[model samples]
Target: MTANPVYEFTEREQHILKLLVDHYIEQGTPVGSRTLSRLPGIDISAASVRNVMGDLEHMGLLKSPHTSSGRVPTSAAFRVFVDKLLDVKPPEKGTIEHIRTLLDPSLNDQALVKIASNYLSNFTRMAGMVTVPRREEKPLQQVEFLPLSDQRVLVILIISDDDVQNRIIHVQRNYSKDELAEFARELNEVYLGRPLAEVRDRMRKDLERTREDMGNSMQRMIDVAGQVFGPDEAEDNEDSMLMAGESNLLGHADLGDVSKLRDLFNAFQQKRDIFHLLERCVSADGVQIFIGRESGYDALGECSVVTAPYEINGKLLGVLGVVGPKRMSYAQVIPVVDVTSKLLSAALNMRN
Candidate 1:
């Protein structure tokens, strides 16, 4: 639909709709009139509530599942509730401190990956996941060459934002470690702190113009560098991919259907899809929420994502986000995700 339809509701209808959505989200079961009447100040007969619920179902706001005699909110009902009724609260101060304190300062990248995933898992009480940040937009921070064989050199790249990338380039002829060191120094002086997108093309033009007369090894080194470090132009194949937390969304009661859950998981598995999603996330600074079917991913049509972009010194570097059932506690998760993204940026910027 192009726009959410405005449903004209009486005070009772509004109260009943909110109650049904809240109860369903909490219990993951159809809500019956009797259960709703027990709420404070309801002051309504079971028959009256049932009549209003039937009207809601007819208006496409609720559904009665086959296995139960109660009603549950449909995607449309949830969308309406999210748009008009949700009262999101920030995570409590104690909870925020617990999350902050749980992050150990001593972990290396790999260790941090595991620790982060576990930490998020515990905090969300859902699957805690994180994806490694994309390295393509990064600027060159440092480069080193390690000699492994007569002709093989490992090109280590330390990029902006503490991201490290390495590639092995084989020289056609062996050079002394002195030559490698000289080349590394030269490369650093010319390209250090330059954006990666500018790095290769500038070098290629320079090398092609000046080094055409050079030996085959020098030419091949230039060629290999171009091949290995190219920037991604497509939405899919960009720099980011999921690093952890694939299993968390499956536990949401709303995603109990295997087919829908599989589709959601499959979307995360596609590196390009996740990268595009993160790219979109980083395009904005604050928490961005994409509800079910709101995100562009077809597989994610049944889920919602809450993401925040983190930065270093005003430059956008990466994103941290969570995907869960559409019934996610946006009030609680948004601030927590926001704090985590800031922590990540601060930590990375400190390292830099």
Candidate 2:
């Protein structure tokens, strides 16, 4: 097989490449040159088709399965197809409304997260993940203490917006329920309705000031809170989270590589890595398409992520996107992810 000489293929190579990828995608198997010759528009002999197949293989666009005399499209070929040949269209209004309905106010955060995860999985035919906003981000509205034992107390933290967190503290000495109430009153008087971060800081400073004068019981309570609300020591509070459709990648022939699946699972366990990958999904603005190696995670090098930022009152807060195998039909997934993200932002803003 001769190299087509033109940097771009002679028209014949273009048609052959498209047919190969499309057939492979539909059948989940390598496509042979004989099948290529049988498709209309390319008036070429089986031998000639084989020649072009060889040329595409040389171009690193196709790979041969050791067991078969056929070729499968590589990530490079998928990238080229998305960039030049994929025909994507916007999602239908009804579909968008359905998505909005699923995210309706009637559902609580946990329910919504689950439903959204299912929706992404079904719609994209891939694994879906959704991370609910952490409760700590909400302000602390109230506090109460319940005595569990002489030295154990259950401290309940409430946020004004119907969010709650509970922590258990151990004291060197026991305090009666009345004493717990009195302590709760004092704490609330000092810090209720403040952001958790602020409340935490003030409590820490107050504890530091009173440490020497305080009795062991009160000091132990303060110590527990200091640990609970202390400056985050985990590098950073990961505000952004992921909900992914991991199952969606399973049936694809391209993902047959065991190493690829292993790496992908490892990447999934590292939320920071996924966050970093999605971070690139929102750049200077507009919908971003990151194909294969462009996603920056080598494990995801065989996948593509199309994401757009979601906002509240024009302020960008986070991004929502889809992660699919590189062979994903970008034309379909892009619009679905893009419009869904906008809907999410709109719904969020309405609550404020």
Candidate 3:
């Protein structure tokens, strides 16, 4: 949710302010009082419009660039406009059908997520992003351990009928092939049908309980099981984020500074910060808008982010959004994001 700035404005002041903002957004340049006075519904002289513009500047809602007598809206002004002034309408039926067609339920999870990101970028002409769904732990079907040279053991995991995973663990001492097989057999007997995370916890507790009287072979087996069932960093990376059309931001005049553009692209490449920002929106309801400097990240000080969370069976999977210049058409982008999330959620539910 965007916080609305508290500022009182008379009917004439509000009318001129809206005119100035609309003109500036369309032209990407400062708007002078004469230009606004000539617009429809002004019913005032250029001099009177200039006086109102000066008052708005004093309120911190507008600023005058040194190069021009015209005034442009400040970030504060955009916040007020988005929260109270702007009227949002539903997306066209054609757009909703296009999005629905692109997000086909028959596609795999990765493909579906990629399509969603592309749709956001193509529709809004901005950088689009989507976080991969967090995987749930599945019950183990079988386990195997094979001894290798140089104190290494290969742990094979059968998570389901068709899912198999392999991991390598280094040990303090080399064990014979027969000993490794026996260790795997013992672990499978106790943990074959349990989820991997729960199995790891149970193994740790069993070790704590039997530590005083356990023999060397049993202790070694427990240690091996711990390594085999631990969190896999490589697997976690698979669930990070997918992005498309980042270069579209390059075409935005407000974001043309070379240093700022480089930093923004770097932030996208190193997704930790952006991922954390999107993660905060996972619990938020409906669409969220973050105008310039409101995103709280230096890289996004000149940009706006619109995001919505997508889910299946009412369980949140992740967030999807677009990053663009602050002057973007929120009336269009907001509905696209809102509808895309719903379509993505419906497609995922169908796939499941």
RMSD of each: 4.5, 6.6, 3.8
- Residue 294, candidate 3: C-alpha displacement in angstroms: 2.2
Per-residue lDDT over 150-247 for candidate 3, one digit per residue giving the tens place of the 0 to 100 score? 99999898864445778789887898989989998998898887766678678767767667688888988877777776543444433578889999
Model 2 residue 62 CA deviation (Å) reads 4.6
TM-score of each: 0.76, 0.67, 0.82
Query: Clashes in model 3: which pairs?
Result: none
Model 1 clash count equals: 4
Per-residue lDDT, model 1, residue 196, is 77
TM-score ranking from best to worst? Answer: 3, 1, 2
Model 1, 105: alpha-carbon shift in Å? Answer: 4.7
lDDT of 2 by residue, 1-352 (tens): 1122223777788888877877776677779888888887769898999999899889888998799988988877776676666667889889988999877755554455457657777898876654444443445778888888767888887763545667787765677888788777877787776666677667767666756788876675676566456654332314446565676687776677899988887777667777776555443385777777776668888877777776555655556667778777666777887777777766766663
- Find the candidate with the highest TM-score and give its number: 3
Model 2: worst 10 consecutive residues (lDDT sum): 1-10
Query: lDDT per residue, candidate 1, 1-352, as tens digits?
Result: 1466788888889889998888777777789999988877689899999999999999999888899999988777877787778787777888767766655444444344345556655566555445454455567888777766767788888874446767887666666677667667767888888877778678667555667576765565465455445433432452334445667666677778888877766766665676677677676858777776767777777777777876766677667677777776656666777877776666555544
Mark the regions of model 2 whose C-alpha exceeds 4 Å error after superposition.
Answer: 1-72, 80-87, 160-162, 172-224, 231-248, 257-301, 305-322
TM-score of candidate 3 relative to the true fold:
0.82
Model 1 TM-score (2 dp): 0.76
Q: How many residue pairs collide in each prediction?
A: 4, 12, 0
